[model samples]
Target chain A: MNFPPPITRLIQHFRGLPGVGPRTATRFVFALLNKSEDELRAFGHTLVDFKHSIRTCKECFNISLQDPCEICSNQKRERTLLCIVARPQDIQAIEETREYNGLYHVLGGVLNPIDGVTPEQLRIKELLTRLEGEQKFQEIILALNLDIEGEATALYLAKLLKSRVPKVTRLARGLPQGADLEYADEVTLINALKGRRDI
Target chain B: MNFPPPITRLIQHFRGLPGVGPRTATRFVFALLNKSEDELRAFGHTLVDFKHSIRTCKECFNISLQDPCEICSNQKRERTLLCIVARPQDIQAIEETREYNGLYHVLGGVLNPIDGVTPEQLRIKELLTRLEGEQKFQEIILALNLDIEGEATALYLAKLLKSRVPKVTRLARGLPQGADLEYADEVTLINALKGRRDI
Candidate 1:
């Protein structure tokens, strides 16, 4: 009766999301209230579409509208070279660079025991399958975050891939430690890509 | 090809929102990617329902699913006292106090000419109408923000209401300047309500 009850429930749902506290959640709910019915419906549809219309690329575990994804289907990209990233957004960051024309492998997560995320829990098995298959990758570039988890994941991947692949590299350390690939400036990404060294 | 071109559009849309920048937007998009198809659809449906189900109260301009709103319809509420707020969320803050059982008036927005919002743009006319009928308000509390704009709006309303209503009181100013009522802690709000003095 006070807030129509449903609005309160919606605010609570918003507050459940990461980084959204009670105040921010309340603001967001009211902001939605300010929107016209059409706009609100559109927002809801977008959220639904984003969830339903999008799928993970079966090949790279990257987000897409299809199974294999456009990148996986494209013949122009170098299948011999694969870039390893922690999340789908990291792949987007690298794609924006327009430097690498290679394929990608999304790990889905980093190796963090504290969070109970292990390499086995990630898409590492898929990467291994791709590497050991008839289509062999000549190089694997680790483009994960520069944080502790990223470093640990990269190191674990490097150790795993070094014995299998011809070459294994990580994004250069010129990138500030603890920086996310998604947040790194294009210039920094380009620099890191160009200056990448053997890891 | 990498992340589905439409994903970029969604991320850009999120970044355009207030307080959401590129990095946070990417985080949100990736979090979306982690959700299952059903969850995504539910999120979308919630958004759409949020838009479709909610309506502004006709009399007080408060966000609700009803016309007069539950608060306005409640028989137990004090009809002689009206609490004026800048937005719908402000009403929530006042309700949490349990001290006030009066009906509410949502101004919709403060007077900000720079953004091209005039007195006519808000619910001022409806407020005046509410006070004009045989059901008159004994005290009209201006519980708006304490910022320059809020102060300006309150002053404008006080002057206008003085000739119409018997009493036009404002929420006390011990509340930190520029602080939003929605963000103020319960103790501060309660104290402000307790220490309220006549303007």
Candidate 2:
């Protein structure tokens, strides 16, 4: 059965979202139908105003309401230590730990050759320019994921920045908190043993 | 970290959806951030226009662009055979089967006292009124789910409708088309055996 044009259009928009299929999209449309008119209008206004209200931070390339973003503009953060990440959401994840007090640079994505993501597509040039500018960062931390693409990107950046910067480092890989040794993968076990510290 | 007001509001809207949590809602908001301005505006317009474009069918209580709905207005459908379902989506499901060419009556929901879903909340009155009207239905099929609420609803309706309608029936209870005898539950196996046909 053919849904109404408005419902079909909304379903199509929802279907464009990540991991959402036709059935889920249809369910979303029906759920929306149950909402009050004012709620629907508010949701619509939010979508329309989303892009206008948010802008890419010029200093760090993180999406924010301000040009420099909260972290970049803040005065108390450790300016000499820069943490490089693949996405803005990663910054939030790190912030939740309350361990890192450094600034952040969002690279947008990793070096994914299969999907055609390269150095030119990333903010590598911008990062180099930032490093070369007046700000003298003591260390550059490649806080990327442990996946293949993240590893390749970290390696490429570390090689390019080794001579330019005082120090370049990647996040330590080890068995995660509460992980069982029996179920721990070989690579993680090896990394955990290699990086083990005396208690 | 606190997101921008617009981003947070949009995330809240996505969080209101069924089965979506804070993380998924945040993911949805970020995904929408990547969409083009024009696409975002189109989606916004669709949401705003959703309620205005759709109306509940007065005759069958189905949500549609038309008041009577396409099914109620269609002349080719079998008017004398009516199928009663709990929701409008069930109508679409039955239509996809291509087996039932009869008219439909959407009950809005079944009788669930725990959730405060009483007979007054459902379209039971509307159904009775329609049955008492000039339309002489040969049979009224209670096509509800086999769950507790559905069973209670069907039993209640059967008792109420047995004297009102010429004939009242229900969908056959048996093993599904691809169901295995070994894996089938005891209740389903008993029903399948009891309802066995000559074939």
Candidate 3:
């Protein structure tokens, strides 16, 4: 049987979300129906206010309430260091470590020429401006994906920034800390062997 | 790093959904934030209007647009036959088969004494009233779970409705449609052996 217009609409909305399919959407809608009127209204309010309440950092392009973002506004962070990443979520991944006190620049995405995502489409210009400006950045960390597109982008950026900046480094490649040697992929094993360091 | 207030609230709302936790909720919130302004607004509107649009069926207790529900209102459905289910979704499971043309009676849930779900708390009064009232039901199918609670509920209902109703039947226990003999549980294998019929 056909569901009512509102429920069908809600299901469609849920289906539009990443990783949610037809059955999952239906389940989510049913679960929502189980909530009290106040709870439903509260959730609805959150959805409605989400965009207006969250702002992209003008400096880092990280999603936050402030344009400069929490990281960019912090005074104690290293001034002469910058970490470039593909998305805002990657910043969270790095932030959770609490190791890197450097600022960030979200590229929006890696260079995917086939998908029409070029250097102009990314925050490459912004990255250059940040480097050229009064911040006097001494080091840049290109923490990006290992895919063909990511490598190509890294190469392109490295070539451009080599003359502009003193040092440009990529994250290390090796087997994960707890991973077994037998289960390691060929590329990872090769990289791990090639990049061996003194214990 | 802490998320914006709106984003954190949205994540909490997502976490309230079944099987969803902190990481999944955060992922869902990020995904929602990625949606366009119009799409997000439409989704919010759907959520806001959801409860107001869907009404519970007075006859069957199935959540629907109309009080009588689509099935209860349908002229083609068998008026004399009633399939009793533990929940409204169970009716959907049966309906997906496209076999049964009978009406349904959603019990909300089976009796679980430990959870304080007694006969008075359930739709048992409504079920009896339906059976005793103007609509003459020929059969009452106890399509409940096979758990101890469900079994106890079925037993209680069976004893009460045996003399009043013409027939009270339970779903047969056997191997599921696509199950292999080697992997089938002992109870199912035994039930399959016991309930074997002539070819």
Candidate 4:
């Protein structure tokens, strides 16, 4: 029942995650124990490297190696349209469509009252500051999930952007309620984007 | 969309696991990235330590910090009873029950001919060696899963052990069919153990 101190500690650490339980943590740690020293080293080094290398983009708050982020800095991308997403993974979902040529504003999280995640907890203030008059975005699309918190955040953003932007839109319905934007199929996401209605 | 070289390599490594997909790999890497530097170092060090610290017990084939394993070396354990399991995790499961005071023999893996895991590939030879009568066992319990591979391994071991030992038993049918032993609830597992039937 007694694992080596390090292995026990590793399982405890893995257990700290949102969905990982002690049993799953044991499975994960044992899998690591079965791996070769080189494999373990690679796994360990990757942990450090991921933390050291990936940083939140200064402009959009999306995870990136670069400061401005590739999406924010790309000249070929549409500058007059901005898609507001909740997380970095959400940005990847949008990009996979190959349809949304616009830049992104990653809020880092949705507004969840139970979690004490308010407007200030997200990158909302940073997002407002980044919206430039010279850049002149004609549309600000809220491509957040269809969940309650996602809806609340999108509604807040839509109302706030309505006064400043020419058009404020949210992705069309039928995206499988309470699910993640990441879980949406590419075609469904693309269709949702194409059929986005003004709020 | 673009991660650094080390982060990319780490995600690829995570993707190499049995059930992990590319998106899950990305999420896992990012989750690691969220860990503090000290935590990251701990995570990395744990992987290396778990692999380096654990060794396969020469007698039982169970992974442990010692050669004979804590269970094998313990004097108070029921030496006349040995539990045959498919993996080290199975040993951990039984140990957690705190009901079984018997020694254990890990087969390392079950016999799965389709996946090329033959009887010879398992620790059947070591198991046979342990039955040589100097420290004779009254009973050998086959605690392997009730799945096809597990059943095959148990039946093979049962045939071999029945010829050599006075009694050969199996964990009861209380366990749900096809589910992993590690996932069995503690009460159900305890019942299964207590209700063990002879083959």
Recovered fraction of real interface contacts per model: 0.50, 0.77, 0.72, 0.62
Best model number under lDDT: 2
On lDDT, who's better, 2 or 4?
2
The C-alpha TM-scores of every prediction are 0.81, 0.93, 0.89, 0.86
**DockQ class, candidate 3:** medium
Docking class of 1: acceptable
Number of the top candidate by DockQ?
Answer: 2
Model 1 bad stretches (over 4 Å) = A51-55, A175-199, B5-17, B51-55, B175-199
Give candidate 4 regions above 4 Å deviation: A175-199, B175-199
- State each model's CA lDDT, in order: 0.81, 0.92, 0.88, 0.81
Please tell me which predicted candidate would have the highest TM-score against the true structure: 2
Candidate 4 chain A: 10-residue stretch with minimal lDDT: A46-55
Question: Residue by residue across A115-137, what tens digits does model 1's lDDT show?
Answer: 99987899988888887789888
lDDT of 4 by residue, B1-199 (tens): 5565777798888766546688877787767666789887877776666666677889888887788888788899989998999888898788888999989988888999999999898888888888884899999999998778998888888888888999999976677778678999887788778878789
- Tens-place lDDT per residue, model 3, B64-182, is 88888999999999999988898877888889889888999988888988899999988999888888899898998888998898889899999999998999998899999999999
DockQ by candidate, in order: 0.41, 0.76, 0.65, 0.53
lDDT of 1 at B100: 93
* Over 4 Å off, model 2: A180-186, B174-190
Worst 10 residues of 1 chain B by lDDT: B1-10
